[model samples]
Target chain A: MRLIHAATGEGFNPPSAKDFELPPFIEGVDWATKPILLAFLSVIFISVFFIAASRKAAVVPSKLQFAGEGVYNFVREGLGREIIGHDFLKFVPYLFTLFTFILVNNFFGIIPFLQFPTMSRVSFPYVLAAITFFIFHYVGIKKQGIVKYLREIMFMPGVPKPVYILLTPIEIATYFLVRPLTLSLRLFANMFAGHLLLLVFFLGGEHLLNGVLGLKLVSPFAFVIGIGLTFFEFMVQVLQAYIFTLLTALYIAGALADEH
Target chain B: MNKDENALWSIFGYLLSGLLVWGGIGYFVDRWLGYDRVFTLVGLLLGMGSALYLVWLRFGRHSG
Candidate 1:
């Protein structure tokens, strides 16, 4: 929607998909963008925090140690143990890293001066999902031999022979294509939409201010809603991270399960 | 929160892929055969039906 003030002759350009097409920080370096920079920063930040938290290990734990261990134990017990079952220990490191990395980068969306969620850039989620896809499939292949794994995935027992024609392709697609695609798309779509929602309110509020006196009064309402939604977005960010990690664990669990 | 809730997502994935893969084939067939939306609709119906059946086989049969 275009908001044009007749008297001022200034038009409000509503935020669109164009807003997501961020420009490079460097003049000519196409890959040097805000999302890439923030992703690197998130990795560094997580590493530093965890390293520092564990550096001073004590029986009577320090606050930082408690916090670090809190996050670690939560992922290890809550996610890795409960979801992944008996052989959960080996996957803890991967699950822990995935949770913390996603949580940190997602929180960047609401952080001042670093307002973009890295996953909003679809490529980041694509890479994460690809890693998850390979890891789970590899785990399955290792657990079950290639022929057995393929058989289990392709043919669900108890199904009639004639039905295999209809169901086999769906089964293959669900495992290989659908799983990773949905995983990445879910994260990417949520972050993309959340950022866009915030942009609509905040940008609309800003544009409203440059209007007549009546519109100026309405701007505060927009800002208020924007602030409220920021809190909502924070909850969503955490949930999305949790869900992504949880699903990864679930996929691993499914792969490791002996029976289909 | 529970494993069942997570299975719900798998059901969704199954249904989505079913529609996409089958309907996609239909669309391509239509393009190849120079037909309008005839196969596309048939493919979508076939997809939805098969997807529901698949879901029943995976999840529903366990209960009943």
Candidate 2:
């Protein structure tokens, strides 16, 4: 039992959250890290792709044109139109930019040589949520007027007077704090956990290769699961991006509605 | 399309805020009055109940 414990404990250097703490590329510059560089690359890549795809302006779109149009239509028709109703067109540009930007950044996790999802860093998602937070509140203020909006949020029309004390604080807390917190946390947690999972399988497989006979024999299974999970992670990454954008649209719709 | 997705997040937000706001209130009340964990438990259950009721009002009635 002791020998087995030692082998398992010493041999297995399981990946933890610490592994995500990548140091800056330059010695003194704190801003330059792997994820930061990957984010910049994602922006450049997305910009160039869309610009090239649209430059020709053909009546009948070629393969590249079709691909760009497909993505645009998906967001406009599926999310913006369904969620925002008549105001959908006004918000499509924001939704399109958000969807494509998040999708590409998430895809970076599985890409060769650049295996890092920028959204996993937490700050990226926080910033995105912050922008959505502002947009929705601004829309609400603009549409309902600030006084009516605040009154609607704090006081439900049907509730009793005594119960207002109980319900109003909860409502305030939910809108101001919990909404943005969960919005950012959901995306960050998914990417962070997915990346950590992949690292464990790959790293464990490599470690097993250097172990005794029994471990060596089992290493291939670890690698096989690792390979399978890469594909699974791709699906999850896409879904997370879609969910994030979908929620943003819904929030905007909620803000625009006359009632709370 | 809109209500279903929004409902999920809204439910989550309601539950979280319920716990934080009510639970914090209970905690401070207990510290002030020196109760032996009574108010904290009461506060949590109250929070959860109200949160679920809020969810029912917001989403269940609408059915979308």
Candidate 3:
């Protein structure tokens, strides 16, 4: 870490992972964190948005209704029909819910006065990943008998019997460990890093404003760049949410799939 | 967006999980046996090989 003093006062304290550890809004309550509140707000926001969007649907839809239907059709045809095959309808609700929930919650990062992304809290993504994990495995088990599912996972065709000893552990680890871990980590990491990036540029700009007159002049560039990155962050947030839901749908499709 | 992208992500997940799981198991085995670096290396190589094979089986065989 380089220590560069601004000649005006103390060195700037760069944002660290510690900034993520936001203090509880309510005293003496372990569960009263900003992420929890944001998560609840997100749920309410999603519920209200969708209900209002659909409540007054007519022959010629309004802009809000069109927007809602656009999102639905995207997931329905793009993800569900393509991935889940003939049984796509059964999972559209789940996929839609997952997509909207994540997309809304992720947008919290950019929304004014609610700059925190709830998924960056780590456990949120973990729970979401855990849900997909359980749902897919259960679907697979129910679709194929337990023994057959396990057998299919553990042994792939065209591989020699001796190689089974090598491949089985990898397959099991990928299915039972890798899939969910990556799913959660990908979302968590993107949000965490995006938040940190914003924090860096914005905070750095503030720090620069307090510096020597020469340094203060360059602060606007930092601010401008920070503004630019926010739009990039928006793109990343949408992409991450899409990827997470897409992977969930893919897993379900894989579970329902007959063979390799 | 397409089937290849799905396969690509799956491949990455499989490769990472293989390394983490087997390499972790190998680390534990090393600690138990007091070997210097043999088990860990073997575990990693085994994991990488098997993961690539699994990727080939799932993506390669299916597409072609």
lDDT of 2 at B19: 88
Q: Is candidate 1 or candidate 2 better by TM-score?
A: 1
- Angstrom error of the Cα, residue B57, model 1: value is 1.1
lDDT of 1 by residue, A55-74 (tens): 98999999999999999999
Model 3 misplacement above 4 A: A1-9, B61-63
RMSD to the true structure for each prediction, in A, is 2.4, 3.0, 2.4
Chain A TM-scores of all predicted models: 0.95, 0.95, 0.95
Pairs that collide, model 3:
none
Q: Write the per-residue lDDT of candidate 3 for residues A197-224, one digit (tens) a residue.
A: 9999999999899889998999999999
- Poorest lDDT segment (10 consecutive residues) of candidate 3 chain A: A1-10
For each candidate in turn, the interface RMSD (Å) is: 0.9, 1.0, 1.6
TM-score leader: 1
Task: Give the C-alpha lDDT of model 3.
Answer: 0.89
Better of 1 and 2 by lDDT: 1
